[model samples]
Target: MYFWFLLIVKSVFHHITPVPKIALPTAQGFSFIALTDILYFKADNNEALVYYLKPYDTKTHSAVIFKRLSDIEAALHYNGFLRIRRNYLINTYNIKQVNNRAIVMANDETLYPSRDRGKVVEAYLKEHFYI
Candidate 1:
């Protein structure tokens, strides 16, 4: 019952509320990153490597966020992120190209999806990349 209630609340609030910026703790302080600026997240065991466009800067930067990929995905999936692989959670807007076995990101990083997710990736490519 609690799970269902939480799901309902999330669904209802997800549409009405603006997506929140993810807070990343650093040695100096905390950094709040806008979801739109994020490119992708690479899972590394218990933490994730976040690649994002720096504000007012053309270069992309990376930070190690102390959260599991699944946790990050849970917070971001509703806001244009896709779990293409077990190790990669990508922002759909930053996808440059999608091949049969690999995806090229905006910053030229290539990632591979699991074979089980091939159909979903292909569908996304067909719907968005192809005419």
Candidate 2:
């Protein structure tokens, strides 16, 4: 069953891989972000916030876009990045530190934990990172 599932997933994503360029305001300049992990972001304006995930790079400025966060997650197979919480989806690479109430970003953007999701998020992070 697992083998069949693997085949199905491989074939499903064989042609839908992301192909875009990410331009960052950093010393590395611009890069070809072949596949980036974007988490769901919904604001009051019926839009979503998205950031590009160019792993293992030294870029700070992420491309923020308004999108249908739910739709994007379903198509991505939930593979590359972990949806830690509903409102906050971070590319683990850019996650600098996790305190009790917030996840700090490389750009010093301290995003607060979801209103009712601190304990769950903390436990998940600890288990996943062995912290």
Candidate 3:
């Protein structure tokens, strides 16, 4: 009963809340990419790469966004993004598979969570994916 209640509440909350979108700078202008379309964010030296699926495109595409992983995680974490590792911020909805050591994104990219965050990851997976 408790599980079903929580599931229903989550479903309702997800539908009630609008999907978040972030503007990415382009050569012409800026493009707003929906958070749901993103697979993950991999941190580079001083910037991060956003990997996402384009509308009607089967292949995943990437763009370099000028932001720190921590900053991006703070902005999107509440909207279904998780900072599994120090350098990786992943969209929970785009998770293909998760294991004790690593998480596989829809694009077949493998990311490992930090040891300190292992329990948090497990709890999240259990609550969201029943893993």
Candidate 4:
């Protein structure tokens, strides 16, 4: 009976999808953020600024990570994150509005689409709407 119980517990745990997380260096030490907490990423000079949803409010808190935006973008590609512009990567699940030239996030932050990637952005918007 114990062997059967252990096997059942293991099987249940194995079928659960693990939460996605990223480790980022902070002033104190490091911060681990679940992907669901991420709101967007903005390109700084040589790093990426990560914006995360704050509890009990519509605002976001930010942290600077010493990683390239492209690198972060690739890491988050499979997690509903989309590179909407040359300098911005947004969480599609957090999008509140889509406009001709910009997207508004749940926190009311507006980010413009890349001029060079206009067609791609349009296609993405259409696909998202259709689903």
Q: Considering every candidate listed, which one attains the maximal lDDT?
A: 3
Ranking of candidates on lDDT, top first: 3, 1, 4, 2
Kindly report which residue stretches of model 4 are placed more than 4 angstroms away from their true locations once superposed.
1-17
After superposition, the stretches of candidate 3 with alpha carbons farther than 4 Å from their true spots are: 1-19
Worst 10 residues of 4 by lDDT: 122-131
Please, what is the whole-model Cα lDDT of each candidate in the order they appear?
Answer: 0.85, 0.56, 0.88, 0.84
Candidate 1 local accuracy as lDDT? 0.85
Q: Cα deviation of 74 in candidate 2 (Å)?
A: 3.2
Q: Candidate 3 on 9-42: residue-level lDDT in tens?
A: 9999989897678899989899889888999999
Per-residue lDDT, model 3, residue 32, is 89
TM-score of each: 0.75, 0.52, 0.79, 0.78
lDDT of 2: 0.56
* Per-residue lDDT of model 2, residues 74-112, tens digit only: 654344344556755555555678777778766566777
What is the TM-score ranking, best to worst?
Answer: 3, 4, 1, 2
Q: Best by TM-score, which number?
A: 3
Residue 129 accuracy (lDDT) in model 1: 61
Mark the 10 consecutive residues where model 1 has the least summed lDDT: 122-131
RMSD (CA, Å), each prediction = 9.0, 8.7, 6.0, 4.7
In model 4, state the lDDT of residue 46: 81
lDDT (tens digit, per residue) of candidate 1 on 1-131: 99999999999998888756888899999999988889999999999999999778879898999999999889877677888888988998888876667888888888888889877877776776672
